[model samples]
Target chain A: MASFPVILFEGGDVPDSLAYRAGKLGAEAYPNVEFLDVAGPRILMAPISCLGAGFAPDFHGFIEYRATDQGCPLTQVMVDAVAAGGLCLSACTASLLACDPVQVFCATVLRLAPSIDAMMVELALAEAVGNAVIHGNLGLKSDLRHSLAGLVEFNGRIAEQLRDPTLAARRVQMTALPYGDNGVEIQVSDDGDGFDVEHELGKPLEVGAKSGRGLALIRKVSTHIEGGRGGRTLVMRFLPAG
Target chain B: MDIFTDSHSDGTRFTLKGVMSFRDRDAFSVILDAVNQRAGAKVTVDLTALEHVDSFGIGLFLLANEQAVGVGSSLHLLNPQGDVSRIFDLANLDAILSLKQTMPATGATARNSAPPRRIGIDYRHLGKAEDGSPCVGFSGRLVFAEHGHFQEIVENLIANGGPRVVLDLSELEFMDSAGLSMIMIAHEEAEAKQIALVLRNPKGAVAQLLSLSALEFMLEA
Candidate 1:
């Protein structure tokens, strides 16, 4: 069986809700940022506002309080991931990040969550990152993906958007944190005008529909899916097979 | 990336300038389209003006070469300078792709330019299936990035296929929702054109996506 240990590094009394949840999941919780003798593969639970926490060698991952907090910047996520001894990626230059960042993210996450299905995480992550880069950052619409002409326009628009330093510089950040005893939670946030989550998710899926399958596919593969930060951030939870 | 094309009676020579990366995917596909449309023609890509290329950009050249060969033509890469040359040397791409340091003599030609797009997936003309239908093998991850390329393939099949075209997806590792949408569009187009677009052997994540999307029926014989 897999295990996920938590270290609360906020340097204060542990929240009762967090403590109870951690206990119910059969995981040990260490309060405060002080050093401790935790067994193997522990994660740190820190406040989203917390910044520049000293590096702790024992922790392998970091999770911010309330998965719904989408204000976490890419640089901060990088700092948190690096400080926690895991992986985080931010693509500021859309041209540079035009390559498959999702591939790198998925590979690193497979290492972080070895118990979860790799392919499921891969497809789910691809959709999220794809949404971030195209819909979020570039502000491209799904209707532009229905036909060849639409695709041409979409590609042209992407090329045009990448040329703009302002839009190109927008970041797409992805971070993975340990969830429960044997699960992982990924937060993908983009710097763009967000969409209507309720309206989009409420729309029925059509087999012949060329667009709008991204969220559906994500909902199918992950254990749960929720939108945050005005639809700019998407959180996906994945649990290992029992 | 800026692709300056000089189309002649026999073939075309493309002058690639600036950086060739995933950002230049649509432009690269146009080059491939040029290569595919004109078979038995020598296709030369002038890299003299090209300064740099990412790994995915390097892959575009390789795929273009593959496309050229499929259509009974040869691809020549000319005059790679600076970092482009060094990187190609380091990757030993010269051994795999034909490299030339010299440009061919100028001839009467027409010039044109175009946009760009990228493809994470690859496809090839796989001759005919058991029923004597033309088969095309598609491999690798077919996601949103490959949408334009996927459209090109479907267009090519519609233009040249007989009564049926088999899209072999056995070697395909993965696909996203956008990929599924493209497949759906292709199926619809083939049906309208009276050509049966047969999807074959989608395993692993690709299979699961089709099943989950209620599109497994597309894989049926």
Candidate 2:
């Protein structure tokens, strides 16, 4: 089971620049399958045939190749596979503010597990990306939401920060991986200063409490939460009952 | 999010369609401004069509409640269903805002009975304190997302010749680091004007945060 081959499929729309970055990040496992063109049914059938050939036969999951282009259309075969209870994972590297990473991530997760509550997934992803953009990359404090003037100032600062080449160029890399038969792990990392995860986790958050509620909710819903690289990288695991 | 307003003799009613999240801040602000303008009128916000609400949206409701109180008007939340209501219940907003299943019938006698007051934010104009000093009372969560507006209101009160202000946080449920920063900013602003800004009754999370930050001296008896 440990020798199960992890396949990687590259779509036609992926740009050369993004491909280079993905390669440099070691986004995919070595000697895996790669599909460059979606012009034929082979791209969709390849995974099924691989499974039929007893290659990672016990493994029933999909890992999407990460790239910049979001226009990679899903085929009926892929949808059918997910519907048949096969887990699906997708990875994407997005710009700090240019892409709606939450939407894309949540949509993919929902498709993978349609039985899961939509709001729960949406909230979790929103908090993840929001933290990555506002607190991680932009270095905005959570308390800035306390006042209208502060919100205005916060917005202004976000705009100003994004105008800086160093800040704007920072990327947020997100990867969704299957953990077990019933669990999914989402890892989001931002290129910014991380915080004291232990200190934040130590704070006592009462139910109905407003401050730090998002992370608290995320903690409640996720099976396990792990932080690394000074809290710049967060991995959340969710096991929705099928 | 789309917000539609309808005016009636009793008050104005706003209907919110679609998700009411942080993304709808502009639309929420429009509603807040409209409600503030109609102070003294019974303002009702119908969330029956609302699909979802985030923490920031919930914070906006708390702020609107404070604004309503400031203008002598009342704000009522009408018919929040599914996720919208669940988020409200989870946050215990029902303890703070007036939640109604249905709106009052038009042309009916206006109900003069005040709604139950729960643990929420409110501002009181204290003409003078026990020591013959001017003061004000602020109750509820003074955390981020609500801090800037809260600061502005406090600043305006201070600018209006109130040299001394005592913000009452007895009912405050929570205060984040941002809230602490705002308080410090207010304290400094008051100091520059040769005024005293005191925080009264810091309890619960507010007290814990102040103590942890080693700024408990801001609290007064």
Deviation in Å, model 1, residue B175 alpha carbon: 0.7
- iRMSD for each candidate structure, in the order shown: 15.4, 20.1
Give the alpha carbon lDDT tens digit for every residue of B105-181 in model 2: 22111111111111224455546767766666555445333432555565665774546767666655555454565
Candidate 1 interface RMSD, angstroms, 1 decimal: 15.4
Q: How much lDDT does each candidate structure score?
A: 0.70, 0.56
Top candidate, metric TM-score: 1
DockQ of 2: 0.02
| Residue A111 displacement in candidate 1 (angstroms) | 0.9
Tens digits of per-residue lDDT, candidate 1, A1-242, equal: 33444444455666666566556655555665444566645555553223121122344444444333333322445445444545555545353244454654575687778899988998999898888878998888888777666777777887898788778767777778778777888988888999877688888988778888889888888999999889998989999977
Tens digits of per-residue lDDT for model 2, A1-242: 12222223323343444334434432222223343322211212122112211112223333333332343323222333333443332222223243232443454565555556554555556566667767787787756544445556775776677677666555455555555755676666676799776677779864323246546556765778878878997778777765
Docking class of 1: incorrect
| Global local distance difference test of model 2 | 0.56
